[model samples]
Structure formats: structure tokens, C-alpha cells
Target: MNNDSLSAKPHYPILDGLRGVAAIIVVTFHLTEPLGTGHLDILVNHGYLAVDFFFLLSGFVIGYAYDDRWHNMTIGTFFKRRIERLQPMVVLGMVLGAIGFYFTDSTIWPLIHTIPLWKMLLVLLIGCTILPVPLALDIRGWQEMHPLNSVGWSLFFEYIANILYAIGIRKLSKTALGLLVLIAAVALAHLAITSPAGDVSGGWTLNAEQVRVGITRTMYPFFAGLLLSRTAKPTHIKHAFLGCSFLIASVLYMPRIGGTDHVWMNGVYESVCIIIVFPLIVYLGASGVIHTQAERRICKFLGDISYPLYLVHYPLVYFYVAWISNHQGVTLVQAWPSALLILLGGITLAYASLKWYDEPVRKWLRTKLG
Candidate 1:
């Protein structure tokens, strides 16, 4: 690797900024989770869709960055670049989660004290590799692949998507890729529509059904994003950042559709959001132009911290959720101040992690690998 190899094509700044917007929404979504009685009542009702949005963005970015450069970049180089970009924050997120694990003692996770220190450390080690843990080893009793940071489950699948792109799918004809996206879209719709919950939500477990959910969730959005990057003929969209961001918020912040009597309504909503709306937003965001220094700086900061923020915020949410569980009758109004503090603190930590840890570590890694 040399300077030439390290040089990257220009980014869709608005898309990066949108990622940060979605990551913050995800944080708020988790922050408010303990307030809700169930899926239908959550304040940020459709925030889980942000993960699908991220997958779509990942695919589009991947296609833009590597699709045509395969002639020059080896698979090793591609993986190395991805690792340099992603792994530092990931390792720090796991360490932070592990450090906070035992302190979050509440009835919600009563078994926390019973788990041995070595077991927690072992799980942390496995989590660093982005591998799923077995249910039997679930120290937090959450049955999550990465119990310390529940968000790691999505990252696990994200890595799988990356590997698939690097291995063979990137070589597929545009028509073949489009067909794959179509089939995946159908699978995703069926999963959402038929689910008892009537939403595309459960992908943090190791069981067969959850795995199917995870894969189905991963396939359509990510593949559609890839297809979009290849096939979309983006045009100038004035104020695209503002417009696209609003579109994303409007869709993701939507109320849960088809309540207890009709889960399928919500299913259709989620499918339509993922299959249709997200791609359009990405296209618009890609087509956007940034005209001012302030806008550029804002997008840069958001893009820089988006991944770190997404990876690290959940550990804090775990503690917050536990606190909420301990005080069951507390209303969201009573809890708003604390939730706001966590949101601000998560952003600060993500920035600190980026400047002091993520940036430096990535630089060092790139130097060494280069």
C-alpha cells in the first residue's frame, strides 16, 4: 500500500451526514426503549429502521468506493481498509461495554453478578472479533450475540455483508445483482409481514429464526443500496441534505402501523420504507451539493463520528435502561433530563474516541499495513 493506494475517491458528504443523523436517532431510540411498554409504544417508534438505512448506505458506499477499483485493489487491501476504518472504534466499544457491564446491576439483569470475571473477559475477546456468542454463555441474560453491547449483533452481520461483497458478489453482472436484490426484497417483505411482531426488528440472537431475520434484513437493503450505486443516475438535487434528512426522519419516526389487531400493516410500512424510501434518500443525498464551509464542516464531523457513535452508545443505553427498569413507575418526562445527558455524553465520548483513539489508531494501522 502506498499513497496512491490510500487515496480514496470523493465521498457523498450528505450521505455521510445522514449517517450521523441516523446514528443519533438510533441512540435516542435505545435511550427511550425502557420508557415504552412494547414495540408499538416506543417514543421513537420506528428508530430500528435506522439500522436498515445504515446497511443501505454501506452498500452504496462500498459500491462507489470499490466497484470499479477491483482492477487495482486486492481483496486484502479492501479488507485492510475496512478494518482500519471500522475496527478501532469496534475494539474500544467492546472495552467500554466490558468495563460498564458489572456496574449495571439491576433486576433486569440480575445474573450480572453471578457471571465470573473471566467469562466476561472471554466474551469481550470474542466480541472484538465480531463473532456471535452462544445463548448459554449469555452473561447478561439478554441472549444477544454481544451481550456487553447489544448493537454488536448488527455489526456481526455487517461484516458478513462486507465479506460477501469482497468475495464474489461484487463481480456479478448488474442484472444479476438487481435480481438478487429483488429476491432479497421479497424475502424481507415476507419476514416482516408474517412476523408476529409485524416489524423487521429481531436480529440479535443466535437461533434459526433470528438468523433468518438478520440475513433477510441484511440482504435487501444492502443489496438494493449496491444496486442503486451501480444503476442510479443521480441528478442535482437542491437542498438535498435538508430534504433527504427530513425524509429519513419522517419515515423512521413514523408511528408503528397496524397495531395488535393487524401486525401486517406495520410490516408493509417497514418493507416500503426499506425497499423504496431509503434508496431514494440515498440517491438524493448522493446528488446533493454542499456550498458552504459550515455545511462541509458539519457533514465532516457527523461522518467522522457516526460509526463510533453508533458502536459505543449502546453500552450507556444498557445502563440507562437498567436504571429505568429499577424505577418502573418513572415516566418519560421525569427521565428526560437523564436521557438527554446520556445523549450528550454519548456524542462527547464518540468524539473523544474519534480524536484521541479512533483517528490515531487508524493512522497507525494504515502506516503499518502500508
Candidate 2:
């Protein structure tokens, strides 16, 4: 690739909008989770796969942005850039989670009152660093590393992927990277099919098993995404944005394929979606263009709020989940208004944080550190 090609980076507006769409679906998934028994019956059945999709998107974007620029970038410089781009929202998400911590008190976590203020503050501090907390220190009873902001676990893995890329993976030849992706894909399939729950969903805690799940989830799609970036040839496609968005939604909203009796069936389905379908969707999104001014504005708005929406929305979800748990018999029909409020509230907070806080922090970081 020439320097000009490297410098004039193409913005995948549709990909950004797709990311925002996935974030919205995730919030809907969490909102509806309390009404279901398990993954099989959840309202948005495959929303958790959004995290995997995110890993893929991150890898592709990173490769596209940095792989060729390595000659001008040191590992330290790359890490700094990644931190500047990502860490601000992470901190903001944790703070929001802390501010709303007490309000989430409910029957599920009866000990919320028993935990002292100092401990909560300490967890918040640790959470800001994106470090995993042990089970002994799990303050929220969910056993999440960042109990206040459960999504931090994914960010933790994101950092890990970045570190790996900086240290060595970025230097690998295409053949070597392809081999690595294949190995990781096999591991992912095994983890998905063999798990007792028949789904690959155990990466929030600090344990051997969960760590395995986390690693398996992170490795395959990320590397596949890296490979896709290296090999993908974008073609002109009409309405690619709409087409790709529909594809993503369809995959995420599909019902469990095999039901409870054949858990591996759903596992295989999830594996195929992550390993094959998501990459195709990303390719389609990246290849497409926003033809009209309205489309461009829509994509821009969604792209702008995508990260903030993903990071900052979950704290409110904790309260929503707690509220639903407290009211046992309330159907989603009765709770639609509150759910709409939470959705709008999350979008509003995310937009405000983007304009007022996150963008300013990032600009300062870029001025000082760039």
C-alpha cells in the first residue's frame, strides 16, 4: 500500500452505524433478559454475540488503520493511541456505574447495603483500570471483574488483543495469521459446542474456565477480522448499508435453533454466525457507501454515539433489571414505557457524554500525546 492510500483512510460509515445498531440490540437484550429463563428464550436471543462482532470490528479497524503505519509507530506509541481513543469512555462508564450503584439495590443482590462505601469506591477505582477483580471481591454478586460496569470485561479483552497485535501479531505474514485464525476458530467451535450450557457465554468472572471462554471468544474473530482486512476487496453494492444492517439484525434476533434438547445445535449455529457470517457482514458494510445526504447523516450520528452507547448504557440496565426483578409479574407489555425511557435515556446520556466529555478528553489527549 502507498503512503497516500494509508493516509487517506476510508471511513466505513455503514460499519459504524451497524455497530450502533448492535449496541442498541444489546440494550434491548439486557432489558428483556429478566423476562426469560436463559439464552434460548431471551427476547433478543443472540445479542451477546454483539460482543464477538465488536471484537471482529475492532480487529478489522485496527488492522486497516495501523498495520501499514507500523514503520512510523512504536509499540508504546500505538498503545498510547489506543488508550487515548478508548480509555476515556471506559472511565466515564465506570463512574456512571458507581453513581448508580446504590440505586440498583434489590432482592437479587441483597448484600448491596451490606457492602461499605470504601469497598464500592475501591471496586470503582479498580474498574477504571480495566483490571479483573477476583471472586472474593465481587461486590455486585454477578462475579463480574468490573462488577459496576460488567461490559468492562470485553474492553479488558480488547486491550489484550491490542497488546498482542503490538507485541507480535501485527508483524505476522498473511499465511501465519491465517493459520493462527484457523486454530483460534477451532478452539472457539470446541468451546461453543462442548460447554454445559451449549453456548459460549462464560467470560465475566476471574476463573480458569471463564478465562478460557474469554480467550476463545476474543482470538478467532479478531484474527479473522485482521485477515479479512488484509484480503477483502470491496465492490460497489446498492443499499449496502440497509442490506448489511438487516443481515446483522437477523443473525442476532434468530431463535435458538435446536432448543434445549440439542444444545450443540445452537452452539454450532452461534459458532457459524461468529466465524463466517459476521465477517461477511463486516465485508458488506465496509464495501458499501451511503448514497444520499440523509443516509450519510444517519450513519454519522449512529457512528458517533456507537461507542458511548455501548459503554455507558449498561449501568442503567442494572437498575432496570433490578426493577423488573422486584416486580415479579409485570410483563413487557406493561413495562414498554419504562423500557422506552431507558432506551431514550441511554441514547441521550451517550450523546451528551460524546459531545461534552468524551470528545473533549480525546481532543486534549491527541493534542498532548498525538
lDDT of 1 by residue, 1-370 (tens): 0011224676688998899889899998998888899998999999999999999998988887779989999999998988887778778989999999999989999999999999999999999988999998899998998998889888888888989999999999999999999999999999999999999998999999899999999999888888998999888878888888899999878888888999999999999999999999999999999988898898878887798899889889888888888998989899999999999999999899989998799899999998
Summarize candidate 2's per-residue lDDT along 67-157 as a digit string, tens digits.
9888888999988888888999999999999999998999888878888999999999999999998888799898888899998899898
lDDT of 2 at 284: 91
TM-score of 2: 0.97
Model 1: CA > 4 A from native: 1-8
Best by lDDT: 1
Compute the lDDT of residue 301 as modeled in candidate 2. 85
Off by over 4 Å in 2: 1-7
Worst 10 residues of 1 by lDDT: 1-10
lDDT of each: 0.88, 0.87
